[model samples]
Target: MISLEEFKRSFKVALWFMFLTFPLLVIKVNPIERTVLWKWENMAFVGIGAFILSVLIRAFFIQKERSRNSSKNKRRFGYIGDEPLVQFILREPKYLYPLSGGVLIFALLFPALFDTYQTNIMTTALMYVVLGLGLNIVVGLAGLLDLGYVAFYLVGAYSYALLNYHFDIGFWMALPIGAMLAALFGIVLGFPVLRLRGDYLAIVTLGFGEIIRLVMENWNAFSHGPSGISNIPRPGFFGMDLSLDSAILYIYYLVVALVIITIFVVNRLQDSRLGRAWIALREDEIACQAMGIDKTKTKLTAFALGATWAGLVGVIFAAKTTFINPASFTFLESAIILSIVVLGGMGSILGVIFGALVLILLPEYLRVFSEYRMLAFGGILVVMMVFRPQGLIANVRRTYQFKKSTKGGDS
Candidate 1:
C-alpha cells in the first residue's frame, strides 16, 4: 500500500512519460502532415493528448492512493480526516463592488483601444453576460434547468422586428412588449412542466425551442421562413439614431449601462426574500415546502424572470445585429449560455460576467487557428473542469465583521 504523496508522485512520473511521448509521436512519426492540418492543429493535438493522458493518470493514481490509504487505516484503526473543511471569508462590498465597477467603466470609456472587430465581439460578449445573468436566476439560484431559453430570445427579437417593421414602432417602445410576450410564453410553458423533474423537464424545454424554430421556418407568411427579418431598427438616444456615424464608444456605453442595470437588479433580487426562497428550493424542495415556501410560485417566478432577461437581451441583440433569423437561436446557443453559468460558478453574479467573457471572447481571439478553434475551445473547457470544477470563481460566503459590543463600564 503506497502513501497518498507517493501515489501522486508516481502519477506525475507517468504523466511526464505521456507528455514527453506525445510530441515525439506527432513530430518524429510524421504520420500526419502539418499542411493537411490547420495552422494550430499540431499545437492543439499535443495539448489535447496531454490533457487526456493527465486526467487518466490522475484518476487512476488518486483512486489507487485512496483505496490503499483506506485499507491501511482500517488495519491500524488510525484516524485520517477525509472530510472537506468548510470555511467562510468575509469581505467588504465597498472594495469588491468598486473594483468590478471600475473594470466596466474602463471598458465603456476605452472603446478606441480595441479595433472595430474587437468592439463588435465585446458587444456580443456583453449580450451573453446579460443573458447568462438572467439564466443564473432560474438555473443557478432556483435550480431549474431550462433548455428552451433561446425561445424567449427569439420571441423578443422577432417581436421588436415585426412590430417596428409593420407598425413603425420605436426600439424603446418595442422592448417591453417583447419582454412581456416572452414572459407570457414562459408561464405557459411553466404550467405543464410543474411536476416534471430533471431530464424530463429539460426534454420538454428542448422540444419547446424546436417548436419555436419550426414555426419560424414553416410559417413563412409571418416569419419569412429561411430568409428571416432584416433591417431591424437600431436603438436611439435622445432622438439621435445610432448608426455608422455613432462611434463604437456610444454603443459600448449603451451596453455598459444595460449591464450595470442588470447587475443592480440581480444583486437586489439576490438580497431579497425571493432569492432566499429560490436558494432554499435549490437545496431541497421538500425542505423548502416544510419551511412554508410556495414551490409553484417560486419556480414560476424563476422562469418568468429568466425569460424576461432573455427577452430584453433579444431586443438589444436584434438592434445590434440589425438582422436575425431562426438560425441564430439554436440549441447550441442555449448550451453556450448554460456553459457560462456553470463555468462562472452558479449563483455568482460577477462569476457569470467573467465566464461569459472567457468562454465567448477567448475563442474569437483565437480565430487565427481557424479549423482548430473549436478543438482548442473544447480543450480549455475540459481542462478548466478538471482543475477547477467548482468554477473559475468558487462561491464565497460573505460575513460582516464589526467591533464587538462592550458592556457599559461600572461607575
Candidate 2:
C-alpha cells in the first residue's frame, strides 16, 4: 500500500539528494579546456533513483512494523515466530544431508566449472571465510573489540615472506610456522590488554597494528622497505611442476579444504567448554569470573586461537599473490574483516560464510559500475545497519528444553 504521505516524504528525499549531489553528479568542469558542462539528465537520474530508494525503504519499514505487531500478538497467545529457513533446513537431517551433499559437490567441482580468475576470486573469499571464523572467536563469542587483528595477519605474512626469502622454507612447513608465530603474537598482545575493555582495548590493538605496519615499512633490511617481497612461491603440489592455471586450481582446492577444516574446528570449538567460557566472558566478565572461569586464560586463548586462523590465512594470501607488502596488511583490511563478522551475524558459522562471500564477491562483480560501485556498496551497508542491526542471520544459541515428569509433577 503506497500512501500519499509516503510519496510526499520520498519526493522530499529525492529533492534533497538532488540538491546535495548537484555539483558532483549534475555539473562538470574542465580546467585546461576552460569548459563547463551542465548535465541536467544526471540530476533527473539522481532524483528518480533517490525517490525510488526512499519509497522502498519506507515500505520495508512499514512491513517490518506490521511483522512486529503480528509477532507481539502471537507471543501474547503463547506462539512464536518461525525459525530462520537455514536453521530449519540444518536441523532436519533429511533436508540437511541432501543440501549439504549438493553444496559440497558443487564446491568440489567449482574450479572445473569456472575460469582461473573466478577460482582466484573464490579462493580470496574462502580465505576471508577462515579469517571471519577466527575473529568470530574473539569478537563474536568472546565480545572483544579488536581493531588491530591485521597485525597477526601481518605477522603470518611477513613470517612466510622473510622465512622463504632467507631460509628457503616451503609452504607446507611455513604454514604451521606462520600460524604458530601469529598465535604467539596474539598471546603477547593479550597480556597488555588483560584489564582493558571496549574502546580502550580497541585503541591499544589499533596502535599495535600501526606500530607493526610502521616497523615493516621502515625496516629496509628486514621487509625490503615499501618495495615489498615479490616472486614468493605458491604452494607446491607433490614436487610437480604446475603451470599457472594448474597452480591456481591447486590453490583453490587447497583453500577449499582449509575452509572446510576451519568451519569444522570453529563449530566444534563453539560447542566446547572454552567456547562457553568465551561466550560468558562476552556476556559478563564479572559473572563469568565469579563462576570460576579464568578470565585471563579465557581471554588469552581466544586471542591465540583467533590469531592462529589469521596467520594460516595470511600465509596463504602471501602464497596466492606471490607477493608481500606492508600496504597489504593495513587497518582497512582489519576493518573489512571485522565488517564481515559483524555483517554476517557474529558467532554464527553459516552467517560468517554468507557474509564473506557477499562482501568479497559483491565488490568484484560491482566493478562494472566503476566510480559508482563504492557509493552503492556504502549505501547497501547503511541500509543493512538501519534495517537489521542483528545481521543477516543472527546467531541462534543452543538451549535445552525440559519436560516435567508425570510421576514427579506437582498436583
lDDT of each: 0.80, 0.90
Model 1 clash tally? 0
Q: Write the per-residue lDDT of candidate 1 for residues 1-411, one digit (tens) a residue.
A: 335765565556655655676455544433465343223455456555665566666676676566566743353222234322221111445556677668867786566676777787888899899999999998888888888899999999999988988898888898899899888888888899888877898999999988998899889999889799999867888788655636455666677788889999998898789998998888898999999999999999989998998998888788887898999999889889988988898888878998999888987877687798667667767877886787766565443455559655432
- Candidate 1, superposed: residue stretches over 4 Å from native: 1-90, 245-248, 398-411
**Could you tell me every candidate's TM-score relative to the true structure?**
0.78, 0.88
Number of backbone collisions per candidate: 0, 0
**Number of the predicted model whose TM-score against the real structure is largest:** 2
Model 2 lowest lDDT segment of ten: 72-81
Residue 297, candidate 1: Cα error in Å is: 0.9
Q: Quick one: best lDDT, which candidate?
A: 2
Structure candidate 1, residue pairs in collision: none
lDDT of 2 by residue, 243-338 (tens): 899999888888889999998899899988999999999999999999999999999999999999999999998998999999998898898888
